[model samples]
Target: MRDIALLAILLWIIFEAFRRPWIGILGWTWVSIMNPHQLSWALRTMPFAAAIGGATLLGVLVTRGRRDYSQSREGVVLILFMMWISITLPFSMVYDDSFELWKRVMKIDVMILLALVLLHSKRHVMLLAWVLVISIGFYGIKGGAFTIATGGSYRVWGPENTYIEGNNEVALAVVMVIPLMRFLQLQMQAKWGKLLLTMCMVLMASAALGSHSRGALLAIAAMTLVMWWRGKNKFVTAVGMVVVAGALLSLMPAEWWERMNTIKTYQQDDSALGRINAWWMAWNLAKANFFGGGFMIWVPQTFAIYAPDPLDVHAAHSIYFMVLGEQGFVGLILFVTLFTMTWFTAGSLRRQGARQPETKWLSELGGMLQVCLAGYAVGGAFLSLSYWDLPYNLMILAVLGRRWLDRKEWLKEKPEPVIALPAWLRNWFRKKPRPQALP
Candidate 1:
């Protein structure tokens, strides 16, 4: 039954793609982030994502209209980064493995470019955000509830056979979604809506802690601090953060505390020590090979030459180190430049959007994206999420928001009605006569 339902939704998305390609893009994002197919028994083996990608491309070609592509330095840097990785492929320590990973990365990057072109409208941006929040927040909400029920005894994991399947990866993903949830909550006018989002935020935070990830601990702290800094009311934000942190920490077991305390004494922790060895290997490899060792450089053969402790071979646990190992110094430079420009661009949107009521949501969104990026930056240092789609998508969102503000698209758009009502109801209100004043 679950498989049938998921398959039905997949077919509907493909059918809709021809008329509205942006829906396909949103569908692709939902599938990728949520891994809904992974939850189903039969549909798990289907090529749902590939099918959606093909449909979206066909939709783009079939749809009749002038479409715009992003022409920003950020986009240029991303493309350059893509080209650099391809350049390093021939020099890859393991050619077959690296080429396979290259294909996957290219697919992700191509969709990102397509998204930038198609998702330029305000409505598209909002829909994309909704998809991201709902998809990732599903885990966050479930994990939070699970934590509460289990008293944070068991660790929360992401969907099987996905990037965030590991405890640490899902924790970082959850922490990043918190600010997006907050941004959505702020857009709500109804009291119940606000309360619901607020609840989700707290639950998501609890879920992050419940993962018992020390990296997530640092990420949540960094994310919270940045969110507070970006907030309109600093004092209230600070107080709220403190209260939430205090309450969540209280729920954690003593074993969780013991695990986290190892951060300060990383030398004695084998896992921490192993990560350091991997970082050294990355540093040594980059220094010798200008283009680095390319992808799949984690093998014992490559580590034998570059790693300080060759026998202690491990994956590049840090995003910085992973890129440094796979793509070399130039790739790392491009990677850093891409996100650095995006960070400032988001800040620019936040400042400019604050000046008007119509664009106030942009201000809130920009601030939250920055918070998300901060979490990724800090948390990514301990996790190998170098090619994660979420961060790049957030960058595209920032670019789109900036484009809208710069072109003043709101000026051309019809003002959204304060209250949408049925025609009959509106006509009745219009025709109804007012009572005479008592003279």
Candidate 2:
């Protein structure tokens, strides 16, 4: 029954990709329901993601006719270099589990491919938006429930027992959806449809606040400011203001407010001191290794050197530090280049799209992608969400790329005249009409 339900969900997602109603349905069920425990469990044991990938590949093969295997582009080149750095560490270092590293790398690769294949049309883009909104909304609801149940204390969920780390990535994802939702609202005419979209936006904003992530708060603020600036209307301005104000108020919970008041004092304390020490340690390790310390090297090294209690220590909190320590300057360059190109490409596309109203959806998508990518980049400054998280993000990039290509093709195609009549009516003058008398 569970398997059937999962399969049903997957089919619904595919059908929704073509039809678009899935966005509302998914937002209500997945996001509003606020459950991640079940999802986490399924992700751990089932090949749900793999099935999605397989289906995508099959569709691509049938439609496009044969896979195109070519030399690596700048993106693929950077990924390869990063993978190489991961496996070729000079010595037995911290967290040096090559197999685990390979597994993560493969997952990222698969996600990129799946995203590229699935997001091939406007319909697909719409479906992707729905999925993201629904998933993030669900995550937010779950986190909110946990926060409430624990009375604002710490909480974690799932079998892995991962803490609800309250990271900004959740907020980042939600903020990206805002512009797209707003675009849909502008295009839609139905009062109920508009109301539903507005509610989803509220849920997303609420989730961002509930996450209690400082970076998320900051990213959402930045995006909201940009949206307001571009809006050029009182209604949009009002909505943007409300979202910003709500997000700001939510960030100042009593405990969090107190912590902010003592920010300077906290920075001078043991927690901050430890992070500084870790940064220094990571920097020195990178300088010594040059090429890399190997994938999974940081954990064991930290354990061997810094662990007074061995079992308590973990990897460096910052993605930059993690890459520098484990993969060195060379790997860092590749990672940075990959992300930098993506940013530039998305930005350039947005600029070009602004002139073509017909391509507004693509332009909005580009902007959304840029903000989400920026959020990831900023988040990377503090935490390492690059490995497992990279694929989902890259997939979005691929989708954007596909949309740009399709738009170009559309521009090159001849335009058809808009008419109210069907094909049969257009050819009516050439055909005989004998049924009028009988009727």
Candidate 3:
């Protein structure tokens, strides 16, 4: 029955995608974030994402959708980054292992391109935002409730086989979406809708704190500060935030605090030490291999050769070092440049949109996207989620919002068209209105 419902959704989305290309954007974003198939034992093995992706391609191709969509220059940098990694994969220490990772990344890149090609309007951008917020917010709400119930003892986990499968990863992803939730709340007009979104924001923050992840704690603090600074109702929101934080902290067990305390005492923590060694190994790999060691560059051999403590092989937990390890200096530059480009685009679009009354939503969107990116920047420093889908989708929104504002009616004010009065009205007006032409 669960499988049937899942399949039904897939087919419906496929139909919608055929009808409107941007609908496919929502479809894949749902699959990427939610991992719904991972919910049921019966449907656990289903290749739902792959099926939907294939259907999307066929639907778009057959429908000839997005014929007039403008491709932004941001995409070229992403493609270049992907191609560079693909080229350098053969040089990787784990060549066979890199193929699977490469394929996974390629799929994500395909989605990114599809997004750029299809997401043309502000409506599409908001719809995509809704999909992301609701999908991730499901876990956020569930996890927050569970945290309250369990006294913040159990960890929050995402659906299996996704980037956010771990407690820490889910917390970080949850942190990232809070700003989007706030953005939605701001966009909403109805009292009930805004109230509901505000609740979601609180729940998601609870879930992040409940994850008991030290890195997530930092991320939550950073993003919350940014949001508070930019958010309206500063005093009320700040008080509410403090209340929620206090409640969550009181619920958290002592061990959670001890675990978090490792942040200040990382020198004494083995996991922290392992992560540092891994970061060092990445830098060494970048220095040695011009192309870097490709993805998963911190394998045993690389560790043996480069790590300060070779016995403890660890994942490159930092995004900066992860790229440096996997893609070398050139790849790192391209990778960083892509994010830098997105950031600047957001700032530029926000500044431009501020001058226009109609496009103020774009300004709101840009400001919130920056808050989201700040989460990734702070959270990603301690996690190896460089290839995560959420940030990329946010980047796509920033880039598209920038482009759409430039080309569309959102910015340019139109002069109202003059029309001759209707026959009956004209006769009446000619009799009554003689004083209209004031200098």
Candidate 4:
């Protein structure tokens, strides 16, 4: 029944995706982030993501939507990066692994293209962010509740069989979601909306703590500082952060603290040493294979051939090293270029949009996104989520923001709204001087 239901939904999305590709994108994102079908006993084996993505592409083509990409540095660099990857795929040392990874990347790249083509205005961009926040925010809410219920004894994980399957990934993802949620919180008008979003932030923070991942701990700390600095009410935000963070830290057992303290004593930690070994292995592989050994190149065979200590093999826990090992020096550079360009693109949008009263919302959103990007940049160092969709989506959002403003000619002489100053101030200089003299 679950299989049938999910299949029916996919069919509907295929039929609807052409007329409304945005809906298809939402459906894909929901599946990708929420992993709802992972819960379905009967539908667990289905290739739903690929099928929906394939249908979405066909729909996009059939509908003949606009495809004019921005001439921004981000757009050009992304294309160059993809072109480079295509050139290197066939030459991969791990042929089978590379081919599989190539197929996966093709799907991801198409999602990015859709973002570039389909999103025309600020509404579309906001909608994309909303979907992302809601999808991941579900786990955050659940994990938060779990943390409270368990007294922070057990770790909070994401839904089963997804990218955020482990406690560490869940924590990183939740940390990233924090700022996006704040973006939504600010845009909301009502008192209740503010309260609810505030609660979500608190719960999500607790969820991150519950994960007991030291990397997550570091990520939350860094992300919290940025959000606090960017926040309007600095004192209130600071106090809330200190209280919540302090409370969460107090709840952790001695073991968790001991584990986290290992960061200072990393030289003595075996797992830390293992990651160092993997990093060295990646360096050696990149040195040998100019084009890279290929995706998932951290296998024992490669480790045996490349690692300084073949017996202490581990996953390239760092995104930088993973890309270097899989795609080589050129790939690493392209990947870094894409990230750096996107960061600047978003930063530029925030600055430009902030100057316009009408576009201040975009600026606010951009600030929140920058915070998320920072979390990913830092947290991702200890994790292997180098190709996740969130960053790419954000990059495209920044790109779309610039294009949207350009199309509207927003920079040219924008009229500011009339101020509603106090009546006393308006009359203060005119007649108040005479009244004061008479008194």
Candidate 5:
């Protein structure tokens, strides 16, 4: 049954890719809704590896035919850095498990390539927004049903699925989608279409609260503030403020309130002290192994050396800490470089849009991309989510790339010959078209 379903999905993806490549971009969305947990596991191991391997093969075949290497210098640098990380790691420590690291590297590489290809048109951007609305709405309804059936506290899908419990990572992903959805809402002409988008916003906001992630809550608050500051619409600003205030009041539970109020207690609590100790241990290890300790090694080593019982040890809570401990300074630098490139690219696109206001679609796309990147930057501080988190984060990156590509295509144009029209039509009915100028 699973094989058959997988085959069906692969076929659908191929068909969509041929007919509308943007639609194929929703491959992750489909994966997320149908079986988020399994997809998450697949992202971590074999499934993602196979998917990436296939994407690489497809890229090879396509490139062979087209022979276009118009990749940016920053792209080349990023790819080279990824390759360096893969090769530099000490695979000899556990040669049998080396494939795991390679799989992770390949998955990230595949996502970048996929994003670049899928984002080459405007239609793809619209398709991505549609998928976000549909998938998130489905999950929201599912969560609501579960909540209703088992009272407010009981999760419908149980602990097996992180999203079922309204996981912080999932909340962060939804928050990232907000700007794109808001942009779509602005562009959409139909009344029902706007309504659907408004509902999506509400549903996503609700799900974010359901997850009870303090970090995600903080991130969403920050994102809302940024959006309000950047947005020109006074009505949207006012509505957003009210919605945010209401969401906070309605969603926060007594326990959550207590936790927030006592967050400073972490400094004194045993669990908090443990995290501090873990950070100290991670710092010492990172200092000793300046290059890297190899992927997934630092935690186990720290557990063995520092903790009285090795069984109790787990990952360092902070993403930066995890990167430092596992991948070392070199890996950390590469990670920073990747994020920096993404930020710079998004910012550049926004500036280009601002300069060329006549290109409305391009300007909107750039603005949305900037907002999403900002949200990710804020979210990453709390969550260890990287390209490896799969389906969700990877999918978000792919959609952002697709939107940018669409804007790029929109910017490209040829000069049209000027034509004289009938005096009556030109003077009374038809508006004169503005002269086309390249930005």
Candidate 6:
């Protein structure tokens, strides 16, 4: 039943794409981020993402819409980084493995470029934001409930065969989305809706803490401090945050505390030692090779050559080191520069939007996105999620929000209708009294 339902939805999305290619883009984002097929038994092995992406691409070709991406600073730097990686692929120490990984990265980049072209208006931006919230929030809500039910004894995990499948990865992902949730909450006018979102934020935070990842702990702490500083009602926000942290920490088991305590004594932990070994290997490899070792460079052979302890083979747990090793110094420079420009751009957009009465939502969106990126930048230091799609999509969203403000496109979004009741209830009441008037 679940398989059939998912297939039906995919088919409908494909059908809709021909008429409105943007629908295809939304469908693609949903599949890429949620990995819904992975949750179903029969559909688990299907190439749903490829199908959705292919359909979306075909839709783009057929539909009447712009196909070119803006050559913004970030976009140009992104392309340069992409080209540099391709150049390094040929020189890869593991050519076959590198080619495979390169293919995966290119697919994600292509979708990102396509999204930038299609997602232009405020409606498009809001809809995409909701899709993002729903995709990530599902795991957060579920994990939080699980943590509560099990007393935080076990770690929360993401869907199988996805970027966030690991406990630490999902925790960081959850931490990132809390701000997006808050952004959505800000756009909402209904009291009940606002409360629901506020609850979800708490649950999502719980999910992150439940993962018991030491990196997640640091990431959330950094994210919380930034959120408090930027968030309105600062003193209240700070107090609520502190109270929530204390409560969540109190819920955690002794074993969880023991695991987190290792952060202070990392020198005594084998996992920490292994990650350090990998970081050293990445640094040494980048210094030795012009384009670094290319993809799949975490092999024993490379470690034997560059690692401090040749026997200790570990993946580059840090995104900084991951790019440094895989793409070399120039590539790392481009990578870092792209994000630095994005950060400033988001800040500029936030200030611009805050000054305008009509564009305040953009202000809120930009601020939350910065908070989201904060979590990614901090937590990602200890995870090898260098090519994860969420952060990149978020960066694009920030760029798009800035574009909207620059072009005065806020007029495209109609203000929410004023009503004493929801549209559904209003319509229902209106229908019952209309028969007498008609007669």
Each prediction's TM-score versus the true structure = 0.94, 0.71, 0.90, 0.88, 0.74, 0.93
CA lDDT for candidate 1 = 0.89
In model 3, which regions exceed 4 Å deviation? Answer: 231-240, 411-439
Clashes found in each candidate (C-alpha, N, C closer than 3 A): 0, 8, 0, 0, 2, 0
lDDT of 6 by residue, 287-316 (tens): 999988989999999999999999999988
lDDT of 5 by residue, 1-439 (tens): 5555655666555544444433344564444333433534233223522443354446444543222235654456567667755765663233445457656556656555655554544454556566665555566545544443433353223234433333656666666667777777878899998997786676666655566555566777777777777778968787967866675456555665665554467766565455555666556667776655556553565567644455556546556666666667777777766666665665555566566544465556556666776676776556655443332342344345434554465556344322234578768766668899999
The lowest-lDDT stretch of 10 consecutive residues in candidate 3 is 412-421
Candidate 4 scores a C-alpha RMSD against the true structure in Å of 10.7
Give the winner by TM-score: 1 or 5. Answer: 1
Ordered from best to worst TM-score, the candidate numbers read: 1, 6, 3, 4, 5, 2
Query: Candidate 1's residue-wise lDDT over 1-439, tens digit each?
Result: 8788888989999887777788888999899888899988788888888999999999999997437774888989999999999999999999999999999889999999889888777877777888889998999999999998898999999899998999999999999888888888888899999999989988998899999999999998898788777667998878877887888888889999999999999999999999999999999999999999989899999888989999998999899999999999999999999999999998988888999998999998899999999999999999999997988989988998998899898888664552256689889888957899999
Q: Which residue segments of model 4 deviate by more than 4 Å? A: 1-10, 64-67, 409-439
- Candidate 4 residue lDDT tens string, 337-372: 888877777777778778868788778777877888
| Positional deviation of residue 195's Cα in model 1 after best superposition, in angstroms | 0.4
Winner by lDDT = 1
lDDT of 1 at 192: 96
Clashing pairs in 5: 119-402, 166-211
For candidate 5, which ten residues in a row score worst on lDDT? 155-164
lDDT of 5 at 42: 38
The C-alpha stretches of model 2 lying farther than 4 A from their native spots are 1-4, 10-37, 40-44, 51-74, 86-96, 117-119, 141-189, 228-252, 262-266, 303-314, 390-395, 402-407, 411-439
What candidate 6 gets wrong by more than 4 Å, as runs, is: 66-68, 412-439
Residue-wise lDDT of candidate 3 within 316-360, one digit each (tens)? 888889989998999889888888888788878767877878788
Score residue 269 of candidate 6 by CA lDDT: 99
Looking at model 4, residue 336 earns an lDDT score of 88
